[model samples]
Target: MTAQSAHLDDELNLKALSFHAQPRPGKIGTLVTKPAATQQDLALAYTPGVAEPVRRIHTDPDLAYAYTNKGNLVAVITDGTAVLGLGNVGPLAGKPVMEGKAVLFKRFADIDCFDIEVQAETPEAFIETVVRIAPTFGGINLEDIAAPHCFEIEQALIDELDIPVFHDDQHGTAIILAAGLLNALELQGKTLEEAQIVILGAGAAGIASARLLLALGAHRDHLLCVDRQGVIHLGRPDLNPYKFGVAVETNKRTLTEAMQGADVFIGLSGPDLVTPEMIASMAPRPIVFALSNPVPEIRPAAALAVRSDLVMATGRSDYPNQVNNVLGFPFIFRGALDVRASRINQAMRIAAVEALRDLAREPVPQAVLDAYGLNALSFGPDYIIPKPFDPRLRERVAGAVAQTAIASGVARLPLSD
Candidate 1:
């Protein structure tokens, strides 16, 4: 690393540890919901009173929602194989990330969380672990686990569990990116069907994004998924089953080759992999989502310097069109939990995307402008997605997802009388 970069890393470590250590050793903790001051209150909270509700719930399992915090409680789980850019740091090392997610869950949606880190040997082991503890939570959020395994674990959990089992690293990023892409394309006078797209990083986020976009009417032939080696094509023997399903038979060999005349570029890969020449090679008014976190595939300034006509987004908060998953997961789960949804289905996801798309096109709130320290903001290239702190996200996104769950018949607690 450069001297400046190394210095920044050191400062980040020092300040981060200090802040986490200050008031407490962690970012989150539990608070009691009921009063237990007197002897009578204690008796009702435990012993005989607690047993009556326990017996009732034993007879009718669904009564847990009425007796406890299960309705609003979500579990943030990780095995630590893919914690941020720090890969495979182990479950214990991933606790801070899970705690950060818990903080976001509470801060954004008033959801209660129990962050759990599992030290499992394999995918089956992890799946078994989560399933064994499933009854304690209203929903399960699988996080930071590596790919192929993440896909398998999530599918199994969703198949076996009644409550929502969302893998945020995949779908959260997909939902937010889809919303931003819709607005970005609309502004550029482009459509998903006709847009030629290239995606770097065929991991969880990348694969999920390709499929979600396809579900949204993006042409199969118009997109290509690429990893470290090159394009995931039909002839590539190394392609995973997920990649094989999305792969196209194409002659493009490298990212540079794929970018040539492409209408959209998405990077969930490493930083600095993209160059000005590659950005310049894309079609006029291109849409770019360099969503690699901590740093992006290309800095917005560098990409914009190549083509001022393009709309660009990054994973950084400092950028304008940040594809932050915080904009989706919290409220999406809020909706799912509110209606006692069995799962977060495709219709619910599309609803969130549409809500975010419509929200971006409307006038920006003064609170949002102040939050970002901007004097004024409008619907344009610079603002294609709603900021995570925007108050409307809770109401709009949650309501949309909840309504879709109800409409789709996945909700057990019917909202309508």
Candidate 2:
């Protein structure tokens, strides 16, 4: 075999070994920057001069950022119950995903982050664990925790912690989906409130997305929540407490009948739940978000085959209108931490959606196309958002988040730039 063939074989072997070995084995590591040159330098750097700055921070708390890494640091915390599309993988198994999130935080937002896989047996216990470690981090990013419980945990953390607490699974997915939906709706000449929408799942992303769509001005009567048992309409005995609450708030038309003729279909459920016939049944030029990871609720080819006037998005990157949460969370947290935000309010999230929507309207940058290795990209029915590799994310998305944080009165330090 050729040398290239041998190299490929070796790479494959390493990957195979990694599956049995730890997914990501190491804990946090530190690097020393300024070396202690002489005894005088050592004394100033280690003890004497360090004391002076420490004393100043004691007098004024905001100086902590100036003297330490507090401004740049973010804590990526997870109970690991819900690991991506892979459900209920334990804390140790979820470390790789958390580490991936930390890598994105560093790469996309220029933020320093550490992944903490807390093995808390219960929801209340998990909240306590996060709160105890809260001071060490400037901001907290909750990741991969399971639903209903995720909702409670997020609310408790935001209420308890002084620093910003964000659940990427919930709000991150919601923000990106909202941005895509906004652009897709406009392209189809439809208004958000007038559209009849259906969501297939009621998990973390689904619940958050439903609430966010409502906040974005979609009428309650126009939205439907469908789980394992048909649609979640009022008087449904099978609905869980969480699903039941949403039912009371939405789907007022007694339209628990079927998925036919809905203006939009957003599936946070598993693969192949929606058929081509269902897509054909939707209103003319319907928008669809089949956001199941690894496999979508309805394949793009099948969806397009049914309705030529459709705008479809999925969580997978290979397709057009990829609605991954990576597009929103890192930049959202970056903006919040930059301003020392107290919390990530709806305004900050909506601002991110608006920024993402605007990005679709502009001419796709050469850098963006090159990153994706595409010959050309355009603004139209097909192309709606920039791929994750687009470099403009650092400034554009973060800037909008920080501005909204300040305007909404949640930011302690306003954005200087």
lDDT of 1 by residue, 195-218 (tens): 999999998999999999999999
Best by the TM-score measure = 1
Those runs of model 2 whose alpha carbons end farther than 4 Å from true positions after fitting are: 1-45, 238-241, 248-257
Best lDDT goes to which candidate?
1
**Candidate 1 residue pairs in backbone clash:** none
TM-score quality measure for candidate 2:
0.90
TM-score of each: 0.98, 0.90
Q: What lDDT is reached at residue 56 by model 2?
A: 92
Q: Provide backbone clash counts, one per model.
A: 0, 0
